[model samples]
Target chain A: MKQARDSAPAERALFYTPESVAIDYERDLGDPGSYPHTRGTRPPNTRRETEGHDFLVRELSGEGPPSRSNEQFHYLLEHGATGLDVIGDTPTQCFMDPDHPYAQHAVGNQGVSICRGSDFVALYEGIPLDRVSCDHSLPGGFAAAGLFLAAETHGHLPELLRGSAILPPLFAEDTGYSSNLPIELHMRLATDSIEFCSERMPKFHAFVEDTYYISDGSVGIVDEMALGFVELREVVRRLVARGLDVDLFAPRIALLVNCRMDFFAEIAKIRASRRIYARMMRDEFGAKDPRSLAINVAAHTSGATMTSRQIGNNIARGAIQSVALYLAGVRAMEISAFDEAIRTPSREAHIVGLGTQHVVQLESGIADVSDPLGGSWYVESLTDEIETKITDRIAEIEALGDVVELAENGYFRAIFTEAMVDRSREVVDGTRPVVGVNINEIPPERDTLLRDLLENRIAPCYDRIEEIAAWRASRDMGPVVTALDNLERLCRDGSNIMPGIVEAMRSEASMGESIGVLRECYGRPYDPMGCVERPR
Target chain B: MTPTTRLRVLITVLGLDQHEAGALAVSRLLRDGGAEVIYAGRFQLPETIATTAIDEDVDVVGISAHSWEVLHYAEELALRLGQADPPIPIVVGGSVITAADQVEILSKGIDATVLPTAPEEEIIATFYRLAEARRPRL
Candidate 1:
């Protein structure tokens, strides 16, 4: 009933008949696996039919020490998870060692501590890298280097590795993640990793742009898809200019989309994003390969949609979003735990999220038919409308001169803030029904267990300071210094920083050190304790 | 506008915690409640925040902490603001903080600790209460 901010408000359509909307099956609703893939990417009635083979059930699992995360990985695997969405701790994401002054408090608090190549080795000690698809949230190519070094040490070839890097251009800059370096340097490092992956780890999806961090419920669903396309275009244009084939990277450019509680809108957004991406690749990028035309989507159940008032309601939200993604033919899916609004998901909450996906896939026969809502006139109309709105927004961004210039000038921030303020006001004023917040009012109760979890066991990795110190002391510093020197040199030479970072990782240089070398090369001050300043 | 309408509140994130949602929400609530709200945005050092508070001549400062670094940053902000003739009231909130953290933050002379999920009315009430309490001292 509600509309996204940018899109036209919900039309007062009492009934939808065939006369209301006309759809040309060939042009608008083409068959799956064909050009301008509107219905689905893969063919209908195949692995996607009845059997849930097409979609990888990825658990967004990780927390505390690498060993603890290792346990989570195994736990998910044991529970029939197809892929592992490895979440790096705040320190790791920020490229800080556990011993760094800023990192001492946050290590393993948000996710798993991954400051060194050894951490990756420990994270996947028994898990075969080649067999399982592992997605990481680490930016600035730190995870790529760490994984490379770990693979080499564990006698696994880089070519056989498969995974995705959540290296969105401004993930750290946009989100409050600690980005020690500026955005330009971060982009360079990310591109370097992508370039390396293109040549070496061909199966690995080098970039996953998650607009959720910036989405923040501020913009419409179409705005989210449009912004993602704008970013994809920018990145692909840069990569194409750098002499890389579009087909090489386009297939691996996965989108991590947030499926909020808007059921039909969320479903439409997913379908629209796929069609738009396909056409953009084929028409603009000259992508001849069908694989390049297709898009891999990892739908994450919206964390912003979860409420602290009625925590259990989040389970229903997660299930609904998962079903939407499944029906939309998303390649990978992650459901946020019910307790995420309060703290890092507890073990029970994590299991519930994983179980939600499993139940939706097995019990709900919705995925048995390809594009279950394909022939529905309402869905088809919504899909067309969403695609048009998103394309218009992308064009709007392009009209604003250089995308980089716009990014630097607080354009996106302004857009996000205005929309967010408007959304929040609507929620407060009862215009937007946010379930527990504005409607279905529940008298608040002091959940002591929730408080206890927050006060005590929420952040499960506090004793890592000593272990990190010990790790630092045991590792030889000479080779680490040498590797850093090489990294700095490579960075200064405007060369790909991947090789040097992998070499540094091999020498046991912590993630922070590798990033520090790049920071130095970029002529930026090295402040591991410093936070990235918000755009003015 | 009356003095109450002119009352200023600065919302900021402390330490390396980059979560801006809490700070932004608080800023919006305080502004909508008729107080002038100055958002310090993210990744601000304690000194920067304290100096900004002094420079802006704000009535109160709210720090959104979403990591363990809040413990470190809140204490640092207090120490910086304490040097002033009239130290500003600082409120901390986020999912990462706890009752123990609230106690520690208050012990450092922060004015209040509002949970992120606290009602908007409660948030607005806290702002006015702290602003009024600090008026005489200022």
Candidate 2:
């Protein structure tokens, strides 16, 4: 670790001595890719030169069947997008068959509707697995399978295979999906997933702790929404102690926290998050591996921060989030388009969004220097101070009985409600200007069709699944049930449920049975007794 | 002479994934409506619907479903009510039936398809109207 300038103030502050500025860089600033891993986490000098071209934004889930997602992937890649983010159909996430009664609701909400291993093979099709990073980020029924296949296809199964696939947490608390499932069951399933990955896909990460959620059914917020990443640390700790080897899992367990409008705060979040995670993993859990402490941001340009009112104002919002990304040490970004609130991303919007990142990477000369905010007294001080705040916050959650209990009680949800109210009041009262919602006298309506088209397009997948249902009825049910039976046995004994699940998947067991096995293990649904008095 | 108006609400659990989060979130919406909600949990049967609505004598029976296959149970529940000496007004919600699907559901005597992940206020307001429209028929 080298120090250029630690005592000088590049920027002055009004609120408090720039907290990020106060960091003891002499003590913490490590090399770009080393342990204590403060400066940067990825391989040294891996920052790609910002492309002059942009990702050709294309709508997923219509016209072409999802089995052919790679066509769309290649098209977008050829056109502009540097990476791919997949949205699988309902059956896969819920662990049901396309024909299952549970999946008939929303088959292909946004991305491709994945079914089994065959669907996964087709989804990736020709996309090179090792070249560009793919974010089939969220994990559910078939998510891990998608990753395993991708890893294997590349023929690079290094003994310790690790990467990110967004995974299920004990949902239903707020995703509006997991609310009905028993929290314990969901927790157990998540735990089982972590256990499974630790043994085989050692180089791969199992959980994303994504807080993007079905939030506001509207806009997005920062990492605070991600099950309180601070508290989620305990989830990792508990799993580590369960004999799965904490040090090995630490390198793989990364967070995909959100970056909202509070720019400096977002910066502090990234810097402070590193220190917080490092100390927690090292101090609390006694984790020796340094990578486990890294905080990776699956940076989504704020959805809530965007304005449908002005329509064009969202571009500015996207830029603000993009700059925040650089300051925040963002690992990967899913920059939102200009009209995100009006509708989904259009070609112009996506290009503009990706272009924003390109501009940052190329013109700003920010990535050339590691830890660009390394010596800012404000950034450093805030890094250390916020490290305390976030750590204390996480400790508060742990006091309530780890991740499962705290989530069941809506601890973070309650805090979020209060924060939203405070933030919303500022927007409404003119203390803060939204440019579209409260500030603009007349809100724009250019993209109502986009919303309607999305609503309208999702209908047919429901009707099509009827055929799958009939076909599934005749596939031998014995293997499906038996695989699930093994899953139950393994889960009850605290053995990793992944192998059993993989076996079931091989046997062509429907996703529903996978979830059923999980529910059986965790016990059928539990309803919380107290109402957390917060939220709109 | 006085006239009373009822609220019409369409609530459903959207998507083929039987996430009970909708059931509870919908329940909050229903409770806010001040109407006796015919609460149906995951994996509901046709009879569960008929019996609960009959027992509660509610103004609106809001059903939650995550998939289309199961929404038929909701429709059958609605149909069972309609085939009776008098039919009850049924509204839908969840990812199961979007606004586009609302028309198909309405053809079966359903009043609405509650949009997926509607907030409590919107869900409640929709029900207030749905209950009013169905009250006369019931």
Candidate 3:
């Protein structure tokens, strides 16, 4: 007989009853779409009736060239996917062009290689911008500039665009997402996009604080939500200080949360997040609009929990995690494919991942009602517990001084490193039961089928060096140089950099050139990696 | 052949693959296992990693890969490290690493590979064996 575990991953009590769980329905657990929305942000059945489905099924699809990613977007749309979650390759995310020395081997390994507005043009060639909701996973200012330019090229006004842009967090350097850029400049670029979009693009989410990477570092559920709120508060403070009304942009701000494998804990964390955001927005910021008080949550399944061993087990894990998201009332979600642990999803694996969402939406009956586990003693108790813990954790983080200072001083890295080591130790010692990794016993020789699957796995392969070179040569240098010079002027003068970025894109300046100019103005090397020097 | 010296190892992630949880954890694991770990951190190029390994006089180098960049950079990294006076062995590991990836890495002159699922004892033992093979015989 095996010994039973009694605590959740967050170290909270596993079981609850009315005696342990105290709830005042009128105050703590109000009706759906009500103030301080503990139940949900939307009215019951809003997803099924108002929204296209119970929830928008958006699978993250991006790999190789823009043309290939465009094909993937159409494929997902044709196969019941309601939205597109586009991600960029690592080099693009780091503001490196294909020809950079550091970007040589990593041109288009994981996600799509997008360097300029032209790449976005190829990415969304035939997909109408207004008809679909596309979420871009890229750095803030660059994503906005590229999309705006693409919309202009396609004759679609920016105001009519339906999508969201990721606002890179202050700790982007610590996370290694964009280490080549200085942190202050990164935040300025993020704010520039938010300020630009607040006046325009009402339909687009101007600021999406993605906590997926943070949580994936093995940070506990409580700290994940807490850190997310702290980052949100910081961004909100920056925008408000810029004299922008909270209502002007608050309604469009959102969070990209991570749905980990903890069934009840994940659900409770998300539900608690809604209540926290509602109270924080109303009480702290003095926001007047009801829409501004409610926080929009889009979730991505935790890729950290997926394992390379027993590859098929990930499908089961993904399905169970998706249930947690639906129960928590996520507006949109992307489930990780079964083979995501080994490589980027193959076409079949991507479709199977999409199929998982469809089955849950149509067959599971779990999405039929809103917050179906609302009044359950265990769930309600857990929600209250997580809510209080997250609030306390936020204060603890704030006590460490400014979030940017903490990030620059290596505070986030230290915590993340400790958390990661502790988690790895647990798995190594069998305290954490990862089925294929530590708990179950299987010899390598007997797992030949999985080996075969791994052997046939396809990674995106592309050589964008010559293509980008050709693109550069084809464009006239006169406007490009002028645009880059103007961008530098704006950077030095402390003006909003979005218009300059937009103008640079209009002149067909590549992302590397524009960012290189900004880098130079900031008194840093043109390439943070020290690979490329500015041309005379 | 039980030579007595604390083994020195260089741990790093090549290129823009920034998933550092595994790499950081392995650094701690090696340190705990009595090895002197020189953690090179993230975004390391092949030439830089090779120079650091030789500069630090490490017995073996470990590349913690969470993406397919390991496959693309493996040959070049092997070539760079091979030019040292006494070539340093390279070991690779990650959650994304599969048996096929291990075979591919081995063919590129990498000495060994460890999966995240490997027990701590197995991981430590593999690194020690690789380090021992690279040691100078008296």
Best by DockQ: 3
Q: Which stretches in model 1 have alpha-carbon errors above 4 Å?
A: A1-5, A44-51, A176-180, A446-456, A460-462, A473-475, A528-536, B1-5, B45-48, B54-57, B68-83, B95-109
Lowest summed-lDDT stretch of 10 residues in model 2 chain A?
A: A527-536
Cα-based lDDT for every prediction: 0.76, 0.56, 0.81
In candidate 3, which residue ranges exceed 4 Å CA deviation?
Answer: A1-14, A45-54, A448-451, A457-462, B1-4, B136-138
- Full candidate order by TM-score, most accurate first: 3, 1, 2
Please write out the lDDT profile of model 2 over residues A57-112, one tens digit for every residue. Answer: 22222212455466767766776566677655544554445554444555654345
TM-score for the A chain of candidate 2? 0.81
Better of 1 and 2 by TM-score: 1
RMSD of every candidate to native, in Å, equals 3.8, 8.1, 3.2
Each candidate's B-chain TM-score, in sequence, is: 0.88, 0.69, 0.92
Model 2 reaches an interface RMSD of 7.3
lDDT of 3 by residue, A414-473 (tens): 877887888887777888788878878577666554446565644545457778878877
Q: Mind giving the per-residue lDDT tens digits that candidate 2 earns over B1-138?
A: 133343323233333434444465555445455544444544445555566565555566676654554444556666776664345566666543545566767766666666543445676766666655556542
Q: lDDT per residue, candidate 1, B23-121, as tens digits?
A: 776788777777788887866778888889988878788887766677766677888877765777777777666557778888977778886557788
TM-score of chain B of 3: 0.92
Clashing pairs in 3: none
Q: How are the candidates ranked when ordered by DockQ, highest leading? A: 3, 1, 2
